[model samples]
Target: MTAEFHVFTCLSDNIGVLMRDTTTGACASIDAPEEGPILAALEETGWQLTDILVTHKHLDHVAGVAPLKERFGARVVAPAREAEFVPQADLLVNEGDRVMVGTLASDVIFTPGHTAGHIVFHFDGAKALFAGDTLFALGCGRLLEGTPADMWHSLQKLAALPDDTLVFCGHEYTLSNARFALAADPDNQALKLRAAVVEGQRADGQLTIPSRLQDEKATNPFLRADRPELARSVKLDGRDPVAVFAALREWKNSF
Candidate 1:
């Protein structure tokens, strides 16, 4: 009984992932930015959604929860720490908690940086993670509710995953992020080449996301902020990992 997974992009720049058990037909929707796209995706796949796995409380992530719940009677599972934001969680989960959609089991990794209660769902066997606004393909989310240290730890956690892990982030900010990455890490030949590739993709109206963790490790500036080249470019005197992280984030806020 192999687990099946499908990713449907929603909103202007958001993703909604569908995970299912091929045998039991149980399915889970990872975040609902909008109803129309989610409904259409489910219909197209002929999936019966049994769960709504929310990553955070941001409207862009959970705005369609009510409608989806009303339509499919799906149980809402969210981080217990974010109960105030996700008040109606039917199942309150915490770090290391596991949720299932039939044979597809996802281990919850609490990553509170983009949001204080944010958590990314990692299906280790599947090599997939539903990282909503914490880590992007070539970038990381802005520090909205959490501090730089919080985001740093969260990113570190995600970075420790298998290099082949497919990172499904929240938005299509890759191309723009690559441009910034070049500015911050000019000596990175791989990042420069990636920027060119991403530019071509963007020019052709393509979406650059769901990037492999390995690619991100090489090209994502947020992840490479510790590199000597990036550290020097950011002009942080200390060269500490935390200091480098802070410089990269500050530069991104304006980028």
Candidate 2:
């Protein structure tokens, strides 16, 4: 009884995901970015949608929720803190809660900063993380509503996950993130190699997502803010990791 996933592009750069539990044939959509693509994917795979796990209240993420639920009679699971915005949710979950899609279970991790109530789903058994707009490939979400310290703490929680974990983020921002990573950590050999790979991926009309957590830990400037080399790269030697993270984020805002 293993878990299976289908990744597809939706509404410009957004990524849509469909997860299925092989034991029970229960399927779930990570977020409803758009109904047409999601429905199309379901039709193509012949997997019935049973649940919609939402990460936050953002429109792009929730826009297709109601329509999909109506189409498939799927249960909607959303963050309790943002329940007001996600009026279609059938279940509201908080941090440390467990969400089950048939036999597949996911741990809910409250990850604010991208939005006040953002949450990511970690399927420990599958080593898969569905991070919506919170953590990108080599970058992280903008501090739209939360502080630098909040984002830093949130990132630390994710960075603590096993090295083998696979991260499926909400968008295809890896190319731009790679460029920023090179500027932020030019001396990083791993980053240089990754940037080259990302370049080729995008140039060939490919997706560079589902990135390995180990690769991110090595090349992502956001996750490496605590490292002395990253601090020196930003000329913030001896500064607190949170401060270094803040400087890197601010630099990325304009990058």
Candidate 3:
């Protein structure tokens, strides 16, 4: 029962991840940011595309859905709310839905706010999470289609996942994310130390992503909505968790 997940960068900074069952050669694409890199990855691994799991309706995330679906004749599975924006779907699922690929079964987590229909695919047994734009490495997606309250609740859902979950998000925004992270939580020793390490990675032109959920809980301001230090920095009038989250997100956007 050997199962492995392969992750690759596609387009400019988007991610295309494939979870595979080694014995069955079955695979599923987390997002369709681009066709070339994903096609190449599939070719190299000799895995059959079983399903296309779309998190949201962002162009960078679903632009290649049409071509990829045409080529592989794979079924499109997306959040029920964004089914209209995504390419034709064979299944429209919401939170708590389960998607299977060979021996792997993933729980569909609805984590909106980045987009009205954003969702995450969590393989509980594998300790992996394909969290599109909802949750990033050391940051989170901007509040585009949802409000601060919406995003705050959405982030809390991801935070509740197991600490060891290996988060695979949509874009490669860790470096810039770390910059804002530093400004928002300068006293956080973990973030301060990681900022330097992230700088070194960027200096070498390397990608800094797939951060552990545990690390994000410690550093990501969005996920730390309850931290008293962050609450002070944001200066929320009340002890409202949502207010703290909103303030932190606003500060990060300007940062």
Which structure among the candidates has the greatest lDDT?
2
Q: TM-score per candidate, in order?
A: 0.95, 0.98, 0.95
Distance from true position, residue 2, model 2, in Å? 0.6
Better of 1 and 2 by lDDT: 2
On a 0 to 100 scale, what is the lDDT of residue 159 in model 3? 90
For residue 68, give model 3's deviation from the true position in Å.
Answer: 1.0
TM-score: model 3 vs. ground truth: 0.95
lDDT: the better of candidates 2 and 3: 2
TM-score (C-alpha) between model 2 and the true structure:
0.98
Top candidate on TM-score is 2
Per-residue lDDT of candidate 3, residues 2-69 (tens digit): 56777789988898888887767777898899889999998888888878888999889888889989
Tens-place lDDT digits, model 2, residues 1-255? 589999999999999999999999999999998999998999999999999999998888999999999988999999999999989999999999999999888999999999999999999998899999999999899999999999999999999999999999999999999999999999999999999999999999999989999999999999999999889988999999999999999999998
Worst 10 residues of 3 by lDDT: 229-238
Please list the C-alpha lDDT of all candidates, in the order they appear. 0.86, 0.94, 0.86
